[model samples]
Target: MRYPENWVNTKPGLDQVVKKLSSLTSLEFKLTDALIGDALILFEHKFRNIGDILINAFTIVTKRDILSICLRELLNPERTFNHYDLFEFVINVIDKPEEKILFQLEEYAIENPMMDVFQDNNGLIPQACTILKYPSIMYEYMLVKFGTKSRVTRYLMKEIITAHIGKAKLIKFYPSLASSVLMDFRWQELDYIFNTYCMAGVPFEPEFLPLVKTCPSDTVIKCLFDGYLSRLFGFKVEFTLSRVDQLPIFNIIPFTHREHNASSEANKEKVEWLNAINCNQYEPITDTFRRHLEKFRSRLRLNLI
Candidate 1:
């Protein structure tokens, strides 16, 4: 362990320290946090981009680190880290207006909203496929954003399956394997949202995503209060962290801090539209506007409690 001389060669020295600190994945969680915190203190006042270093350090606390901590806590019964804790930590580390864990985060919560961007057709799917190489990432995101109640997986897969992903019958594949496969690949538009890569297919939008002023959890909970909850079997649950910290509260929204509004006018046509997607019509979005009753969105709930 060494500290660079503070009197000179500050930038190079800072870089060296950050590089070393960021790669410390083998260390215990508390030690890693303490060491990184100490290292940053050495250069904290000397740099403009120290926050990025912090974000990188936190990101380095990978799945293995979190799991190790959780298993240890289960045996020891100390406080455990949840997705909310991790997300809040990420938010705390971000100083710039555009930094984020979610891609073009604005598009999901506020702009396109619900973290969904609609295409009249499958135009976005292929482009998304180029960047999102796995199905499971999308599945996890599906749980994260809209919860298990959301029909997005069913709809997204309708597009993929309609493109003839396979000729399996609806009776055989629709409910089980097909559903799971689509859930796995729902976040294929990762690059489009993040705008971090240069794939030939996806049009990279380098536009800045303004991080909302509200708590990220609040925004996330608000996004889940749609009419979709009505369609779910389980009322509500915590977010799951099975493999990589998946949020399991996919079935219900908390009454606390929820931004509620009046019950929206019952729009039969729109209800029917989502009903189609629920059945896996992939093109479930003929009338995207009416796909959801947005008037009192985040206000409604299907949980009978």
Candidate 2:
């Protein structure tokens, strides 16, 4: 996609754009840096009718260099300012009065899928999650501009969940708010959200347990339970029967063979045949439930084998 024609032809347009970018203070610098980088990369590749002025500006706005400036200026401990202001500034640059620049940045993010434009030194995923706390337009901007099903989305979801769990007090104060934010995203992504946030060695917050319990899908419920179980076990374990050999074996029998063997064997054969005929017509649901429980138990690293 081409840069807007008006942006290309304006007098000293590139300089004007750079000046506009440099004028960004605090968190706004992050957004400006991202946009500037996109512009620079496009100009460098000679993608469109970019002028010499713009080309020079692109050179000055190298990705690493801009990030360094951000770390030094806004994120530095010596700055004595609420660094959140930087977040606000970044949000404004994207959603500010000028629609042209915002559109250009959006287009750039789409065109350059491989560019780590929104990330920090560690990565864009974590940084974006941190910025999401600011309640800025950039949160939505980043989510929508980047394909939400992409690996980046999974990474971002993980980081966002991590950050949220790190600040448990916020979740406690506004449980509905947290839930609403999570609900805004597609449900298919819930597995990554749960695995990334809850299974990442963070302490389980009692308040968050309900969210997992209320999930509509058995798949997600399984994942949530797995995460909880992992935390409980202090390590990961595949709770499948085939993997039971890895766990401690327990040989406690609930009943003696003489007590129930004849009745149990007859009932088991009848139930198996019934299951084979009408898979959904089970009564009391005890057999089906017991079977699944046994399967789950077999997968657990418990004293039952």
lDDT (0 to 1) per candidate: 0.30, 0.35
| Model 1 spans with C-alpha error above 4 angstroms | 1-53, 56-88, 91-138, 145-258, 265-305
Q: Candidate 1 local accuracy as lDDT? A: 0.30
> Candidate 1's residue-wise lDDT over 1-305, tens digit each?
44356634543444564456446534643444344334434443432344344444444543234322322222221222222332223233334312232232322321222122222221133322222232233334333443222233333322332222211122122334334455334432331222111111111111111111111222121222231233232224332212223234432222122233323322443354335334432323212222333422332333222
Candidate 2 TM-score, true structure as reference:
0.25
RMSD to truth, every model: 17.1, 21.2
Worst 10 residues of 2 by lDDT: 241-250
Q: How big is the RMSD of model 1?
A: 17.1
Among residues 3 or more apart in sequence or in different chains, the pairs in candidate 2 whose N, CA or C atoms overlap within 3 Å are 26-86, 27-86, 27-90, 28-89, 28-90, 119-124, 239-299, 240-299, 250-303
